[model samples]
Target chain A: MTIDPAAPPPRPPGRPRSREADEAILAAALDLLIERGGGATSIEQIARRAGVTRATVYRRFPNLTGLLVRAIEWEYRNTTPEALSWPDVPAMVRDWARHLSEPRSRRLVRRLYGTVDDLPELLRAYDAAYGSHRGRAVRNTLEHASAAGELPLHCDPETLQLVLSGAALQHLAAYPDTTAAQDVEAYFLAVLRQVGFPSPPPAHSTPPRRSTSR
Target chain B: MTIDPAAPPPRPPGRPRSREADEAILAAALDLLIERGGGATSIEQIARRAGVTRATVYRRFPNLTGLLVRAIEWEYRNTTPEALSWPDVPAMVRDWARHLSEPRSRRLVRRLYGTVDDLPELLRAYDAAYGSHRGRAVRNTLEHASAAGELPLHCDPETLQLVLSGAALQHLAAYPDTTAAQDVEAYFLAVLRQVGFPSPPPAHSTPPRRSTSR
Candidate 1:
């Protein structure tokens, strides 16, 4: 049966029970994860929240870890796939700003990072699924920037990626209340500039020369 | 009662039970927090691990949240008090390198970041307890660097701090197995130089002048 990804499944009369149940389960798991944090979330709680029987949930997901992984996959499935095709660094930066502005996104990321110790597999699964792809996209953009002379001579793309990721995490941590997308974008741009990434595409400028080694 | 911070109390014979219990409870809580992650930890589990009655645990810590907060406090109490008096950026950097080299420390930090959504109060208590003082120390160091002309003309210490904190978190995430202190120090120094922090105390260098506005 064909399923529309965006449209909510039609009311009980027409919707496929299996697909509807899957969405409910995934959404419920995500909600519980964000609301209570991951530690307190349980299969029983998820089942209850989703309005589905434990047997039904178990039929689909073997365990809580599997369910959590699927739920995260569902949550990010929409965004990460297209991230690789993003046209330029600025567009990616804008998207990052918009996503980081959402309180839910920030909370979700925090919860994910929290899983590193207890459920290393969950994060590992996530990284394998989407993080690597997203990383490649960013690296491609950075290499393009380096080729275009937008980055400083000493800047390594790999190190820049680390610094940029760190800046994003730190910005989220330090300014959780700053929910404005523009504010987030401004902060990101500042970090980029501080790391010597020329923004707004400096026009008619000479290629960057390596600063003299001290 | 004056309790010695370093030595474990004399075993059972003339030792005070309350202090011993407190130590056991705190230690157990920290262990569980690091080992299993925070969500799965419970008072019953902590009490069991600590070999104390739930009532005994409850008598000291009124609730799980309070207990968790206290556990975190106890975890950091020994180190934070001395952090403010660190002599210079290099000393602090070396200490940071040493701390990040420990797998336990990396896991603890990831777990702490994870708490931002579910148990923000836990992190907030931690921040209030130690993070602010640490921030002041870093800020003071950055200001001293600026005064000494060790930073670039366009550098903002606040932004640099954000970038540095982000970089640390990213480094921990990206290279969880790089447990050598020297390697971590090198990564940190590279980051510092990338951000224009002029490491190895540049010999008699002229003060930085602002790069032309883009």
Candidate 2:
């Protein structure tokens, strides 16, 4: 027997906003960012490229900075760690280094970093978001290592998290053009080895217990 | 008998550039930076504060970025490292941390880092200059430690250099508002302890050996 047809949807609105238009605008922003850098990307240009009016773009995003930020977030979401599986600590670190050192990622960082002079608020927001998200992951990794005895019992997990995240960010800042993936991996391994991780032969030494006197 | 008198020298064609004016401008720029963030400091305001015409300021520096950069370099030159005798590796680390974590140093770094987005060329020049100067000091310390058998013999000095510098910058960036000088000292001490520095009690159960593999 044939199934009964569902009732038709109600048409209460004049014209529904198009999801395709939103995606198009985001894509156009990403393209512009890749081609001209972040400072040069404009909402008007994005609207024109997406075949939408400037008002439509503004209606979606309150300001240029907001639009740019969302566009970057969208691109980052699409091209980040979500799609990939990280099997082990070393493998995960390698993946992270590779992703961060890519040309597109470097350009995005350079563009955002350059905006700190004129847009301090945006810079603060970027740092806050980046730290909150990435910092948590690094902290979790260190904590797990500590719990598993992969890290020293005396290891300060918070400090380790800070060092890992900070070291990674500073490495990117200093060597924007060069991909020191192997060096980064080796550096972390050295740190891990220092922190009582067993590699080849077991770690030769233990970290000292805290001293009572300063 | 009386000696013959020397002849008077000829007057210069034009008044030599005023050292006082240069010093005044630099001092004013620094003051303005401390009061207002780097982005808010202007060449016109700096010139007015220095009691020099805009043309004179331009004659000294091509633009505001150049002026600010020169002022920063001047500040760096004036702040020479204090003559302190460190009794041990931990003591040295503590001294270094205290110096960098001071309010004056933090303010300078915040201003420079905050402005890096707007002035890429200036920022590049600043980093290159800062790195070269700081790198030399770090190299000396590392070399001394290696010579004294303080560091792992197989450790790549350049890699260690990168790691230490990256770590220091990251620490500063992470705790921009924190004045926990002791915490900085403790953090480095932990790292040093992990790396097998010769603490008084020698906490490690066994001695660390240089790794054979790269």
Candidate 3:
């Protein structure tokens, strides 16, 4: 809970209970929603996790379903439509690797897809969030790369993005279970190497572009 | 219904009402299942489509729900676990291209994906059907390509399959309104070209083998 330091003074001696309780409740709800699928997650459980009284939770959300809708909305409040000012190409590359490696991010993906069978509406919302939010930034960064002559001369921006994201999406779908971070790292590196990233190229050895062994 | 020539021939009485009715019902049920989707499609609609009495439809399938399950099964009766007996790699390649281009195949894919939201159980069954029935053959064919020394030295069979199928799957999911055959043919060809298919390489030189333009 962030208080507006410039505009607001302390209302009273006690902490800001409303904002703190709201954040805690949403965060805890998010955790349970992802970790426990739909059926096991309940308002009581969210209240226990948030360490707020049931009355406090009820005040914000009348029921469990309503809380779930809000929890997802809260989680997505700051998600950039795409990569936002990712420093540079290398940082952007590293960003993808880090997401796969980190426990929380992986769990988030697992939790999202894990609900597809049981809660298709939730999955639909997830798709809407996932599609526009992060895609634009990555696309912008890739376009910048092409403009800067950092990509192959013939590279189509959409095609390159499709290859990179599409390849990763396949693995993510095939293995909904938590993946090994190291394996994912290795996989990312290999994908980059194969695609022939122009800057800070990994190795000298890549196959002939137009091979014909048939 | 085929009459065995060696055995007693069919009595020249009349058409087999039961078998004919069953086939007509199943065909109509499939059409409605895919066209109208799960909601509006009902036993009454199916009976009308089949030009059969409501009683005849009921005798064939006791209820609408039971009919839906059987309709999917009937549609998949001829599906091979993989490309059944292709002449060569090009033929195997053509197999995928044809599937994407042909109306029936594309419609089948569209209908299957279109059901994910409203009919999750059907989708789950579809995953089971699609997974086991087709994945093995593609995997086998790709392995054969690698064994033939036609793949890039650094190629991973699994990754290649993932990229090809995953990329195509993404497009197929996005556009279900029967994509133009030429567009799909081009898409399939581009996918194969990028994947570095060695057999009968296409015109035009490719990018630098180990491009480091930066």
Candidate 4:
């Protein structure tokens, strides 16, 4: 697995795990996860695909479940809670919207959700590692926006979280095939409007409007 | 499966299916569905649980898959698309909000979503049955509300659908504990505001307000 550069170094041990072996195993597991999914992907298959010995793969990850978890984290490294841990509402929303608008992102989300029912451990692990990441991302970003005077002082972070996650879930439902940036923006604008946001026409053009009168 | 009251009756030769037998089997299947979920529940378990022979259950449902579908319909008959086919945004919103506010309803939704990944057919059956029910319900209701001049004439049904589903999905996330009517209504009102609806205090009170002098 690709460790974050900022993360502390691996713990001291008698023999260190091979960095190259770790990458190959994770890469193989990641592909199987998407192609075959949770219940179907096997450690044996991962070993074969990675061209690594089963003993070597098991030595690093300990079990198939642990390996799968590491693979998920590795594949979706860009979507990690830490990656979205910043506090810029528009930037975060735009970033999130753009990412989720992709078909591949939708598939990844679907795969994750597909397993949430059958794999309780995965959900629990995600809740801890990601801090229930989707909700946290929107809540933190909106809170920052409200504090920054970009949103109403009384903007309800909880409600904004609701709008965000809700749109995301339904996006998987109604617009699963939609990968265009404009489509994501339409949904994003609709959400901002729902929360009483005085949305800028573009990210950089949020001018205040004067009420038109005859 | 039990046909809707308006739906035409099933045809021809064989002796009529016993109402009591159908109810018992459905009740058993529903309980098992919630208790064990889609994967673990089976025709054998359902037959044993209902105190009916395997042949009897199979005769009515054809297979475990069909039985599960009927059970879903049976458990959620009240929330079925036919039940919400009418166009009354306020009433529809109230009903939808109330249904979603129930803990049982949330559990049901979670269970259904939990299986959507592995069981594409379940999702397909629901989409066909409900006509993407969440979006359709919101759109139909908003159409009525708009025509009645209760909301802005320019209100977008598709956008409203997005907001409603977004809120519902978020409800599944952050507000799993919220069963209050007021909580659902709070989210509902935010959606109305997004659409520029001059929301009345209640269904009975929609008086136009005079602008206050500063």
Candidate 5:
């Protein structure tokens, strides 16, 4: 008997689309990306590892770039830290640095840079997502510090944003493989101190209270 | 008569490997690089602009990458400041920023970044050239500043090198089109001030005293 091309494939009665299939595909894509880098990963390999037919993969993503973008978005959504309620300026900046310096995040960033030259649209989307999410948190922290009189009075939020984000991004670019989380933290603290943030008081010492005898 | 397959061509009677031809080709290459970025220029164009035969260009430099590297070296040699003496640390840093912020240098750097992914050998050559010239100058400046009490005592020269070079490189990358030389100067000044360099004395209306009044 001839199969009908227009007909939908038969499924088990009352079965919903499997979320597990989506996860498996994305996980397979990430593995391929990390193993082979952006240039070498192919749709065929991804489909094979996902244990899905090529039709299923293509139905989800029209092209490799689409699949890659979706895979990145999934990874980012899963990896991003939960909303932080920072207690102080120093703590907030440190947390921001920590989030950026994580190994998975660094790998994602490198992959983004690798593809940026060929896929300008993808780069724009990545930047928009990054700016909307991480950028907002950084700006909020800077504004809070300014209001608390912790940051220099002359500091412009935009300039500070450029300095912090640009420096962090440049550090990643310059040292693609070897930079560590603590290195990022130290650099952040140095930048803060350079920009006139007062160092936090030493935890080990309590100053003597002035005598009220006079 | 058929030319011998393995024999080298004899030099023309009147032209003894003209030095002028080499200089003209190099000058044309530099001009093209500055005006048209890297990807658009070719050896044929360089030869035509220099009023030399394509064979002459090939004879001087076997490949395009070699030609570009030599052009960079020539540019650096010709443009680098001859006066080694720096009156102050801040002035030195500001001058370095100003040089890198120039349009020609910025274009050269962008071109270098473009080729880095495809031509790892060329990248290594560029790095070596840069390190030998600019890196040495930077190290010397930091050492001089430290000895003169201009730089802070605690700053490691190597760490300072990475930070300063990374910052300067990123500044070029960020503002590739603008003639914002003053922005770079201001940035270097801000970095200097942050690192504890003494700010220039404020302007005074009255004439200075010859002797101390204390």
Candidate 6:
């Protein structure tokens, strides 16, 4: 552990390297939330888990609510695929199956729903930051499917969106354990079929192309 | 309001008339839970609201968990219709619409979901006492519909049950405010149509008879 005189001194609090600390703090908050639910989580616990001082955490996030909201937003950004990347409904379904199959995802979702009464701001922040964007993307996909004649003639896009979202919630509640990604995807496909989605996902006349941005 | 010595000594604490006090306490517990959410509710408040002593409540139920569980069960018994009473799925949908339109019902359901982590026992008790029974009934209804050609040929009864239950949850999360019963019913019917339920409801050959038990 020789100190190199030519090297810059260890970075102090609020230094240019603070971005690294910021990410660490947010990641730690999300981890603690998933492992120990909302009621048991605390700033002290998060700081300890992140290997930072309490002052470091407080300097970055003045309050627990702000920190939690930021942490959840980070998780959404890191885990969810970009809304515009999916080529079709089946692609979206496949991505959702992968997300839902993970036990960590299910636990985090449960905490979100379970905290609505206590910390409604968290859900509101999520809705504003990610939910609305994802919802619009889904609606667009459904509309395209309807136009392509892949959906039932009378199917309403709004109702279908609600049904699909509800089905996800229902799955979390009904099955708390981890499941195989393929099985979950298969189940959602069956639900789609029941809801008038054509089997084989309607070979697009234009053959939808994957987004090149990703 | 004169006390008569001939009035059977005012009915001691352990008398058979305790059922009256039992109902009062349970009703009060539910009222407090709905009005103030789960985290803020307590036995003392329930006792005061019910016009009974705290000891009376404790005598009937030893713990908060037991009291809340029984209170929720009592609510289900009083509000939900018998499983066998519905002549068809449409009838059940109508009843659900009415239930969903009530602000009190929605708030109570929110509490149930919000307390899942803090009070896992409460949700588990509910699942055992009422959820399983209601789930079976819904499954039976869907199965009947499938046999009668009301549902799509590819529709799976289990999947449909999950989707319908999920839709109810999604409705609650999306719209926290009370809606017109007719609007809710219409929305649900549209969902059913999307899931392959024939519109205008099926005309029964036997003219499905409503149960006369009531």
Q: Native contacts recovered, in order, as a fraction for each?
A: 0.71, 0.21, 0.18, 0.45, 0.06, 0.74
In lDDT terms, how accurate is model 2? 0.64
lDDT of 1 at A45: 98
DockQ, all candidates in order: 0.46, 0.16, 0.13, 0.28, 0.12, 0.46
lDDT (Cα, tens digit) per residue for candidate 1, span B1-214? 8888898766876358778899899899888877776667799999999999999999899888788888888877866556565666677778778877998767766766776666676777677667777778878887787788867776777888778788888877668555699989888888877766657765578878889997
Q: Give residue A198's error in model 6 in angstroms.
A: 3.2
The Cα error of candidate 1 at residue B119, in Å, is: 2.1
Model 5, range B72-160, lDDT digits (tens) per residue? 77665643435443565666676776776677666666555544444444446556656456667777888777787666554656656
Clashing pairs in 1: A39-B39, A166-B166
Clashing pairs in 6: none
Candidate 6 docking category? acceptable
Which is the winner by TM-score between candidate 3 and candidate 5? 5
Give one digit per residue, the lDDT tens place, for model 2 in B1-214.
Answer: 7555685565664544577789889888877775555667799899899898889899988788778778777776644433334544556677678877787766666556544545555455555546455566666677677777777544545556655666676666655546678887766766555444444565686779889899
Candidate 1 CAPRI assessment class: acceptable
The worst-scoring run of ten residues by lDDT in candidate 4 chain B lies at: B122-131
Segments of candidate 1 deviating more than 4 angstroms: A1-15, A79-88, A199-214, B1-15, B80-88, B199-214
lDDT digits (tens) for residues A1-214 of candidate 6:
9889999888786665788899999999999877765556899999999999999999989788889999988877753445445778898788777878998878887777767767787778777766677778778888887788767876878889888888888777766556788888887887787786865735568768889997
- The sequence of per-residue lDDT tens digits that candidate 4 reaches over residues B1-214 is 8669997667654544577789899999877766656666788899899999999997788788788777776665555556665546656767777777887656656656656656555556555555367556667777777677776544455666677777777666546445697778767766555456555566666577787975
Q: In model 2, what are the clashing residue pairs, if there are any?
A: A114-B117
Name the top TM-score candidate: 1
Model 5 chain A is weakest, by summed lDDT over 10 consecutive residues, at A114-123
Using TM-score, rank the candidates from best to worst.
1, 6, 2, 4, 5, 3
Sort candidate 4 into its docking category.
Answer: acceptable
Question: After superposing candidate 2, which stretches have Cα over 4 Å from the reference?
Answer: A1-54, A78-85, A110-133, A152-156, A180-187, A190-214, B1-17, B28-42, B48-51, B79-88, B110-131, B152-157, B193-214
> Per-residue error at B161 for model 4, in Å?
2.3
**Which of candidates 1 and 2 reaches a greater TM-score?**
1
| lDDT (10s digit) by residue, model 2, range A113-201 | 54444444444555554535555665666666667766655466776665566566665566645666676666566655544554444
Error of 6 at A84 (Å): 5.0
Candidate 1 local lDDT, A149-189, one digit each (tens): 86777677888888888887787676865569998988888
Which residue pairs in candidate 3 collide? A81-A133, A81-A134, A82-A133, A82-A134, A82-A137, A83-A137, B81-B133
Q: First chain TM-score in every candidate?
A: 0.80, 0.66, 0.68, 0.72, 0.77, 0.79
